[model samples]
Target: MSAPCDNQTGGPERPSFVTDDELERALRDAFARRVATPRPLAADPAGLAVRRARRVGRRRTLTGLALAGVATALVTTGVAQLGAPAGRDGTPIVVLGDPRGSSPSPLPAESTAAAPAAGPVRPELDLIVGSWLYTNGGERWELTGVSTVERAQRVPDRGGWLLTSAVTAAGRTLWWVPPNGRPPQVLLAGADAIAVAADGRRVAWRDGGEVFAAGAVAGQLLATTRAAAPAGAVPVGFAGDTVLIRQPGRGGFRVWHSPTEDRLGTVNRDVLNVYGVRPDGLVVGQVSAGTPRRPCLALLDPARELAPVRTGCDPELATDGRGDVSADGRWLLVNGARNAALLVDLDALGSGGSGQSAGPALTGVVTWTRAGAALHVDAAGALVRVRPEEVTAGEQPFSSPVDGVAPGDRPVVVADSRP
Candidate 1:
């Protein structure tokens, strides 16, 4: 009736339907008896071993592929970081330090406006006015504990940048200006002369014919070598791992490689004053040429074997060892005549003619502030920026403690920015 309720009724007591093929399979499986067959105990052992080995090889291959994929991902991540902005390049902004107990002043606040899309912000010039160190912004930082600063140099060491100063007090001392603005650390208490690596990672100082080497950070001494420096010898600079030293009036400078303290070489046998050392391992100095009163600037290789490259004889273009070579080693500025300053590209210093015009004659000492410019300190303690294009000098709102400077204010030393 009604086609047997369509085998599976839509009513409550519905019957389950089974196909003939399924019923047959189920019946066969329930009634069929399996035949007993002997399985080979250990078929060809070598064949089995080969099959097992193949499986292991496949597993190893898959694992290696996975590892390779991970490695590729890691390398890709590193490459991406490499392309990130210079802010990730480990470069640091310039900062100021004080010798007195005062901490390092905080860096200027980052501008809220969009930053310029450019490479690193070039460091500006730093000034050492009397016992005070002034930032480019005219902030007067006290050089608290130290007395008189003979020479000041901003150093970029491995640990961090430091403001390295050679101080003259009871005796010569080497003071370290921490980038964090911590109180100045005494690198060497009793030191006659000091030389810092342009990178600011290493320092070498001489005290009574003995030389000591240390890391830029405050800590124990790195090494000591007896008779490393001669009497009255000052650490002029560092050329790579070698330390260059010379007396005030010595005809030349000698080089001593650190750790081993081996004599590397001597340069400028007849040159009088070794002025500045470039980061590229070149040295600048003055030598007697033409006449005793007439001196010429010389570009010399720190290696003794190289001959001195002298500027064409210029009597007025004399240097008082009061100048600096640009961190890039492309520019050099030295004090010329009393009212004039000397400017020369290091690349062309060897070929320039005598008495080449280097801009207006500036009074007082001309100390390099940046690359192609020099900070001319007038007799009245006023600082004027002299460049290849123009001069920026005048009375402005310089931070206090400077007090617009007093009559006694003088530029005892200069601590300028470096690459």
Candidate 2:
């Protein structure tokens, strides 16, 4: 797709965007280090370099032992399936980690399995190939036919999903691929910062700093309320009815919620990144290394109900761009340097965060769904699913990961069949 901001006479248009190739390498190196590095046996290491090398070799053996232990202890004893019940308000209830050994309950038996029949057969994975969006399945539809896909999301409503994207040419346009086997339809133009609600019925985006909401299936304009966001605030997501936005950092980073459009509070400027803000007002982001502080993952409950929790960050932790948090708000899929993912359990925030061996490393956007699935595009451009339990296991299984179409097919959106 031709970029709009290019200089006709000389230089290249648009700043450098990282390619999928670079991301794959980074993910491989990061995962290898996290899976194998051993804790120092001695309090002091005056001359144990050789022993450390040997310890590294033992990591593969240790991984096998760890997996065996998990089968015996975690699987047999029934460690909870990593979930929490919903709060009184319908948002998932988030409790602080016990640190004393108690853990949250496992997901209900039904959720631990594939999502109910009401959910989609599979979640769709989308990739940006110039301006067009192709589906690995389905009669491939080129969203714009003539424009580029700037951003896209699968509508969350289980009744059926609408694949929404911002198609850009001279100006940005909004469009949706309906579930009824119809061709892609244009919703509007000149929109940016588009986000779809969990139910996939509502779509929101920014136009000249004004945020607008519209019906994805009904084809109706919902609202165009003026936002009080600070200069340069961009609409990022929708948690239930609340719209989450990120503001550029001046001293401390800030995330503002709309309708109310109030700042989601943070403890300090050291909290330099915003991965996501939950419908319940929980903010997950990174705390940059600063004076008297080491880099860490910070979970800020803006309601002031819980103490702000910060766990020391891994030197390899990658907190670039934004990431996908699970529907229950307990699991988050993070992409580190080189397209590697760090799977974080929100309930374990006070403890050091956990890592996942996201097989083959993700090369594109990673997203989570209410169906308990984590989806992403791998380095080969193939769409894949990595189950939560598989991720928590922390080792590459001997078996192949969940299979899907390979790279170069178009994008797919996994959403429920439209009623």
Q: Tens-digit lDDT track for model 1 on 1-419? A: 54443446655353468775665565545433332344643454444555676677787787679758856864775421211113223211111122233312344332233322321111256656544555555444555475555556666432322334445454466666554434455655545666766556677766654555555533223333334455566776776766766755645656666656454355545666665677666677676666564667777666663257555454355545656666566655565765555565656664644333454454433456545555555545555555554422222212112233446755533544345
Q: What's the CA RMSD for each of the models?
A: 21.1, 30.5
Please give the lDDT score at residue 290 for candidate 1: 63
Number of colliding residue pairs in each model: 8, 24
User: Which runs of model 1 end up more than 4 angstroms from their true locations?
Assistant: 1-123, 128-132, 137-142, 157-169, 218-226, 248-251, 264-268, 289-294, 309-311, 337-339, 350-352, 355-371, 391-403, 411-419
How many angstroms is residue 171 displaced in model 2 relative to the true structure, after the best TM-score fit? Answer: 4.8
Q: What would the per-residue lDDT of candidate 2 be over residues 1-419, giving only the tens digit for each residue?
A: 84455455646554467564554555545544655447643442322443565566687677668658755763464522222222212211111221123212332212122221221233344333433333334223333343444345555442223444444443355555543333345555444456666556666665553554444444333333344344555555554455545555534444334445433433245555556655465767666653566556667654442235555455345655546667667777776655566676777766654556565555545566556777665555455676778767665422222333323443333433211
Name model 2 segments beyond 4 Å from true: 1-147, 150-152, 156-171, 213-217, 228-231, 249-257, 260-271, 277-281, 289-295, 302-316, 337-339, 369-371, 397-419
Q: Please name the candidate that would achieve the greatest TM-score relative to the true structure.
A: 1
Worst 10 residues of 2 by lDDT: 90-99
Q: Can you give the lDDT of residue 388 in candidate 1?
A: 50
